[model samples]
Target: MHTSVSLKALALLVFCCLSTFAGAAGKCERLVATGNPEYPPYLWRDPQSPKHLIGANADLLTLIGEELGVKIEILYTGPWSRAQDEVRTGRVDLLAGAFLTLPRLEYMDYVHPAFFVTPSVVWVNKDKVFPYSGWEDLRERTGGTLVNNSFGQQFDSYAKANLNLEEVPSLTQAFQKLLLGRTDYVLYERYPGVALANTLGMLDSLETLEPPISSEGLYLTLGHNSACNDAWLRGQLAKKMTELTAAGLPETLLQRNLERWKVQQSQVVAPPPTQDDSQ
Candidate 1:
């Protein structure tokens, strides 16, 4: 009789716990976002697994999803261009991270209080020196940069008018051109440049110049035509993101993930220890 009563109590407890969890999770079932899989120390595709993306931005998004009672999946859909296309078409609900662009505004609504900001820096080969103080300094040099990568509204306008840059397929390609002396410099984010350079074993060969070409906020936005776009969801996310920013969550995550990447990358480079043969 005692065993029967205990079993009934346990079942009732499980039912109540499940009901509470469902009530919380009902706010948002899931949110999908994708962008620039090459970007690191912010976002990037895990080398060990192509389908999963890992980095600072991914960590922060996970926290945001938890706060919203939703599952935020950062998928490696394709190249940066394809991800942007998906977001624009509303086939994907969100752009994982992006800068504010006039064109993007037409198809997506940016959430309030951007999660982070990053600078577009110029990286040059160590032996090839260019004293860069501003964008005008780049006007004379033939640089390489990824296609569809934007620095900012003002910088983009100026670069289009005055800068001579060869648009490559990806950051790695652009950096390769710079390394091979095909391009004078490469335009990319500072952290990603450092991360990629380290990954490529080119850390000793490259240097990032100051000042940055332009610094822009990295944001999450909902596609305008998304069937799941809800005003309440947008407002809730905005509030939560702002609170997260105030708590310095994104910055903290970036540092932690940066260290994690270092460890992971080192493990990749090192060979496994051989079994002892002394016995």
Candidate 2:
């Protein structure tokens, strides 16, 4: 009886120790995040290094990492279209900038409230003015936008069904088409669109419509399949996101980065216009 009791006590102690170790194990000590490299003021490839990402999202994530006591590496693994795939496959732990969509939820979880809210706007050459108040205004006019870009599910559906829109490989192509008067209008986020226009030195030629077409929140989302996607980590991220939102950190980050982006654009040489590919 004494032997049996001693063995039982030993087993219980071992189980307790194991549980403590698991609870204390640094499973989420570090994280990797990535996103579209072309999105300025939010995320973009480091001008010096294509492998690393930089911008407001990177700045905000660094702050988050400090708050959470974790090391977060934001990288630009590839093209924007493939960024989601990298996260979905668990090669990337988080998408530093993402929109919450039903399709995306299947692969990852959104950490709310969003880190930023950006408005998708219509951009037209100063010479190609058109009467535009809403999405319906574009039904009769042809528009160009970046492929794989989503304003929102509703707008995405509407554009597919009613709008005459062409998808190009990059926003650079879309802007080039607009500059050349090949497309009636261009659709893209307001800040990035303006940043692109400034970088291209076409701010005088292009103008964004007031009352944006659609506004979407940009979030820090964790891939469900990521090795670091633990409940504890997710919970902490959600809490931190909420705190950041309440503290207006997102808005501050956006505003600060907007100026930073403009400064960066001014210092760098813009790429030459690309061939029109709005088919």
Candidate 2 ranges with C-alpha deviation above 4 Å: 1-26, 269-279
TM-score, cand. 1: 0.83
Pairs that collide in candidate 1 are none
Per-residue lDDT of 1-279 in model 2, one digit per residue for the tens?
Answer: 999999999999999999878765448788999987778888776766657888888888888888889999998766565778889999999999887777788999999888788898999999988888888888888899876677877788888899888887777778889889889999988877777677767889988887798899898999999999987788888888889889988778877888877776778844433333332
In terms of TM-score, the best-performing candidate is 2
Query: In lDDT terms, how accurate is model 2?
Result: 0.82
Distance from true location, Cα of 264 in model 2, Å: 2.3
Clashes of 1: 0
- List TM-scores for all candidates, in order: 0.83, 0.87
Local distance difference test, each candidate? 0.82, 0.82
